[model samples]
Target: MAMRDASTQTEATGPLVQFARFDNGKLRLFSAHTHELRYFAISHVWGDIGWRKIPGIDGEFLVSAQKVDFIVNQLPDLVGDTPFWMDTLTVDQRNQAEVIATVQNIPAIFRDAGKTIAVRENDGFYACCADAIRDARSIEEFRNQMFEHCEIHKDHVQEETYLKRLWTLQEILLSDTVQFVAIRGGNMDPIRPFSRMISTIHPLEVLGASFFENISFDCVLVFSKAYVMQEVILRLPAPLRTRRDSIYNDLFPMVHAASNRRASKPRDYIFATMPQFPWYHYPKNAERMEFGDIFLDYWEQASKNGFLSACKMKASMIEPQVRRDLGKSWLPSEIQPEPACLGDFLKLLGGQLPGKSAHTGTNIHVTRPVCISPFEYDHPSDIIEFIARMTQRSHFRFCLSCSTGEIPKDQGLKNIPWENNLKDINMLDWLQDVLGQNQSVLPFDSQAGNEIFSNDMRSQGASQANHFHPDELEVARDYLYTIFFYKNANPTEDNAWWPGVRDSLCRLFEIAPASHRLLPILLLMTATICCGMPVSATAWLMRFFIPIHVQFGEISHIGLLARHENLQGHPTPRTMLCVGQHLPVAPLLAGEGLHETFFPIPRRHDPKRNVCFGQELVLIDPEDRAPIGLLPDILHADMDEHELWTNIKILYDEIAEDGIRIVPLSDL
Candidate 1:
């Protein structure tokens, strides 16, 4: 290219660097900071053919396809007298020093440009949407005109490769005005103001039908709103965009939305998004920063700024992936792709506790310091097996006591063993005490039985007449009668009868509200597992199922546990469960020389078998003096193993609650 000097200048005494202007038949460079330069920046994908040398610019490069079409056919008419910035022709990508400098200057280049032209080689849908958007007078009118066209092209819209690219987010956001170029017919669509699009189109309406159907509608709505908000920030003037508080709130959702998008280089995921954060300092040796190092820097900064909570909350929503390892205890993983809203994620984690703040909002609150502790488990499979065995044993013992009319009347059933060995003398002593009382067995319709059933029906929401079919009620009633009276009257000694009793009891536990003592026992057992104590200790503790109070220095309202073995090389380990406070209690071991860390529960069939072995537990820390928020206080109740396991499973599957998988004993 030939160089030419111009009069206008912004600052500095140095010679203004040359920028190529591809107008007319001439190839000439003008001072980037001079000549009152009004340029449109070109953002397009670099295809496989790579860079080719342009004849007039020495060995300096231009993208091969751009030399053939973009400059020759599309630019002259569209840009007219204005100079345009096309990286391929303007920057010497072959020169490492020049490449680094250009990369660092990208934010300024895009921001200063009069407009950004996005060149896509696709046809149909985008062209149609562009035309409709260009003609609409109002957002509602735009929506009305585009809705049917969007539906017809929904598949094409969803499958658009351009939308899935990471750099495109910054390219479109930094520009004041953007024009879409469809290369199919060399059509340059009308320029649409970037800020206007943000205000006009609802993100949900842009979602294709298939994509829309896969997520919860409410979640889609929430995410759609968040998308618009992020766009609004991106369109802000540079100074406002750089404000620490304003940008920090948008980072979580922006990161989440970008997770599934493509990055040619792994580290580009971080670098490409950096333009959105004006506060980010591009490293001196920007290209040398490794992905892990970049992520660590981000984590440290986010934690210091209190953005880590939002990151953690987003991390709780998705499953863990093997390749990406942003797994520090506090850092959220970008490896796991989440398509739903934060509200939906919380619902998936066992529906947020009734009154608790969901923590999905953008407002940054003072986060209390959380104590991290390792849960004791050699393998997740081991915990899974233990849960199964303990659950079966507990179910057996509970059924035996109920069948023999040994359950106490006033305080409900108590002192049930966690073991299955029926020959223990304590069982005989319990049986003798029941026999000596000579308590009269009441009919099923008696006031006490009526009261028990009524309470159960209320808890189960079966009190409403329409809740269950007539036949379902008969099944429930028959099972209750057999366990409560028939089995007691018959007094069978057959070993074969045990299976029926266990099955009947499991069903009863499912429909009936567990006895008052059951919840506390369950809570204690969960806490024991979280503390990394022996399983046998938990079993022994079951004998004293009376009102038990657990104390910890600080407690995690929710936590996850996975085998430390699986997390050896991972920078951030997946958590197993979002253990609510009170139930899963672990000691605060920070600065106490405890290097052990817990991971989230891996999916059962996850190839990472070493991590998936145990029954997951949720625990609390006693030392934390921070406000508990909405964590439920541990209830005082005697719970059978079956009831305890069931509640554990319920909590494990709660929406947005991370980790903690409950594998059924029968399945094991």
Candidate 2:
């Protein structure tokens, strides 16, 4: 999946059927039924392709010249409270709403009357936006309105991290020569900064490996109509509260109380936020899942949409036992926790396995605990590598500059790459340069540890590094180290950004092009497990078994089936015909389609001893028809004990009828 920012997200997939900028001046809605891409813009003004001034969408406009407030009024009543406003708007309304919103809320500082804005950055646009904000009432509100607007704008573009924008905070994101043009006046790039100093609006992105559940950021400042650049400057290194007021020491209670309110209906607007799912488990994406289990993370966004009332109570819905075992006690209350039953866990496992039953099966089956684990929340190595790169940027230090409350004092302008503070000039872990009067930067690519120690006695300039620049090796190392150290650095399981991370990983990355993303979901963490041998090998073989072998396919040992007598929970049943409620796993192991019972290799040989190669095969899905060729031999296809195991390969190909592709588990 791609790293989705707010701008490119508004691009309609398939064919954009309809579009319009509403009189409310803040909404644009569109939908592609086939693609299920319903969009809504809710900020100043959306910037995208239009399909004429369609009728009907010209509904009653509300609010004022301020597009976000106006669009807010235009929406069908009662939806503003939902996590994403799209839940309330109609399909057509959503699309048009998106376009209008994106175009409108563009910061006044970045608005260029008629100048051409490069897709990357244009100075003219920011000037116009800066002028508009001079009279704006609440800076926070303006920032919120703008961010909410852009979130809809770039919800779907795949190459999300390195986004291709339509306008900049100071100019149009597109160039005047081609794809885009100025809306109001002549095309000319602006060469000025915003007239007014716009206060930064650093919104929080949940931390998760999945799509929406945890993709939320610590804080990202709105940079353009559809993009939010990570803020690298802050007044304090702590969580800040709302800037609108000066009351209260900790605003936790206020924020919590505000969070209680919620929308009562389903969302109609569909942007890039889609629920993620495991690929292999989901039939729609089965083929691609061969690489790894698909992670359905779109739920991250849903969860972030302000739906949780009581997480403890909610967990009970899935497994009340979990709640009983784990629940906080408040006041003098005594909700004595219930002891977990080992037997119950066993039964749950057995139910899914073969040769187990409520009447006869006596073993207790337990799976990996349902609670989230450290690995689940840990950022994978791939994304860590990216962090290493991002930290080396001349702008790298600012990436982590964020405050939930007020902005911090600027750390004066200096030039010795800020990878390290300016205490010592030549130590990787030590300060590289002091904060005095040096403006030279070394943007070379190498290990931070190696380069910091040996500086070429010859240099004088600014360090110009991109995301891949190793000058900030310390950045990746420290960022990843911080994540490892911080208990809750990841927002997945605790319900911060799990839904977003899950959905994005499954839909945008896993099921689709594998690495559509530059970094893991939360700065660095993979949501979906790609189904393939290389990754698995790198994990199990390189890390566990063989240290020398780094080859991809050479590590096909991951999919091998062990004699897991407890596959589901109990032993494989030799004969379900004799018993009543045959366990689900018993038949599943009877080769491919075991549900329908159309084909059975072995009817009832022995129910006591473990069932293996000689065991019968039963096909359940295809009208009780038996599988053709060597399916019976395939399931019972053991290598060590059976003599034909050696010659089985030759016979498998010549199975009388059709030619089939067969490879050993080692070859897979």
Candidate 3:
């Protein structure tokens, strides 16, 4: 029978439950009001066996006599004669109103009950393992023996089907006192406490498929059941059992966990987890508010405020290679054919899965510093490509010119390509022609106006190779030197000039040799040196071209570069997150950031509203620190690079304390 809709039921009192009590040679059924909150609840997988008519019960929907005997015999020892609620008996199958009422309050039934006894009907392996390992003294000894037993009797291992049911996720998560028991051969076996089970089996289970070589598939399946059971226990609030307040932190994890679960009815996939939302209430008219709208309303509230904590924890835990694969701009929409689980997403990212945790919020209150750096790229694409090149996968190499860190380094520039017309000449000869002693660097000679850098500018932002006549050298060198020296040396550096030149370079070379854009920068540096131009010119331009830097506390090194898209004002800075902690497996923001966009996601509260994704924010190294200035010109011409870095650092630290401002993303 269908359950009654909200209008017929009071949300606070909820549906009435038929509780079964076994007395002296008799079993009696009595209805209990939910508000009394006295009965314990039973959560188990319903078997395929036909119903058995209890002598006094007046219905065909009665559960099997074996299950009734298992409950009557074993449940008393756990809860001591406490009346319990089971769906088959407690929910009226013949009445539609009672069914709807009971279904709507499924979450509350488990949550409000005095205790929840999770019954494993088929599996006897746990009982066998417990009996065999009863003599073990230490956890190590228990685990070793447990693994051995699982292997020896792998053929008989049965996975806990209760853990795989979609409805049971909430049943176990919402329950305060969840006791697991297995009914085997008309006997009951009490499962050990979650703490001991996790300590005993988690290490081997984490080894995953590799650990299954010596172990049988049945054994692996049983261990996986233990893993899922452990996952539910981990999500529950500890010390104090009921934490209605922490549901926001767990919402996304619940959704992801449900991906692996099975539901009898398709809509039950959504309905089962509905009670986990703290904002959810039993509606007066279930037909009035479509489930889609109700879910979107919940998603909107949850997506914006709570997930930063989980994102930060995941960011801190993931590896360096995974972070690089994301390359900063990865929003969830970018991944082709959405991933099903965290492991699937990590697999798609081409990285190893990290050690499993609940991925809950760390509750650390931190903030993201939003200070601007003087080094602005012409377009986001320029920086994206440059960062992509630094990775082991990309071909761009900086050689020895990179001062920020020694990376993308190779013995003196290897792949600098010359223009198509000059390809016949060796690169050395080409350089000599352009910068030889008698030659004047190309410049504006109105009559035969030479455009030596026109091809370079078109192909690479501000840097490209072009054939030049000896007479064209003077104007080209002078023009190059003016733009370089003025922008680098000007007390009031006009950040706008480079961005314009950078965009022009991108537009020109978008269709050029995709891999060789950086070649022109190196070629230009070589030209400056061959022509007896100042050595400082090469150093100055290198700083601008590779503007990004990263550090882990005092250790200055190249780690990962992320472009912050929240640009404001001139001289937009790409804020570098310096993780003093070990390298994380996922980019702090982008990994779960994809989940945020796609939906089905699952962090900590900051009373001050200053929580950030990563752990620490250290000062950038002075030796390699790039000059960063906020808009409206914060620097004076006389200021030294060290002093400019110091002032900017003070602001960085201050802004970090203020925290990042979270703007809710648009609906997916």
Top candidate by lDDT: 3
Report the lDDT tens digits of candidate 3 across residue range 1-668. 13345534544575566777656535567876666758888888765546666554555664666676665566557555578788886676666556555666786677677767777664433556666666655445656676677677654444445544556655765665555666646332244222223323433333222223223444444434443232222223323223233332322331231133456542344456554554444444433443323333333343443322222112211111233322221111111212222322211222111212212211111122333233232343544333322321111112111211112112121222224422433222221232223221222233321232122222232122223322223322332333333233333655555455445434544544332323333334432222112223332222122222332232222221111111222243344432121112222342344332111100221212222122222222122221111011112223356755543343234333333222111111
| TM-score rank order | 1, 3, 2
The true-versus-predicted C-alpha distance at residue 394 of model 2, in Å, is: 28
lDDT tens digits, residue span 1-668, model 1: 12223312222222234566654456676666522566777777664346565444445454645434655666667667677777776776776666655654566667677777776544223545666545555445555666666656544433333444556656755665556654544322234212222222433333311122223444344323323222211233434244354232432332232123455664465556554454455566656654434554554454454333222212212212221322222233232212122211211121111111222211111112233332222232332233333323233333322322222112212232323212232321101222233321111223422432343422332112121123322232233333333233344454454346545444433343222112222333433323222222323222211111221222222222221112223333222222332112122222444333233522231211111121212321222211111122121124545555444443333322453322211111
Per-residue lDDT over 316-400 for candidate 2, one digit per residue giving the tens place of the 0 to 100 score: 2212123222221100011111111211111111111132121111111110011110111123343333333322211111222
Sorted by lDDT, highest first, which candidate order results? 3, 1, 2
- Worst ten-residue run, lDDT, model 1? 346-355
Model 3, position 358, has a per-residue lDDT of 16
Q: Which scores higher on TM-score, 2 or 3?
A: 3
Q: TM-scores of all models?
A: 0.42, 0.20, 0.39
Predictions in order: lDDT: 0.36, 0.22, 0.37
Where does candidate 1 stray beyond 4 Å?
Answer: 1-18, 30-37, 53-67, 124-158, 186-239, 243-246, 250-259, 301-562, 565-668
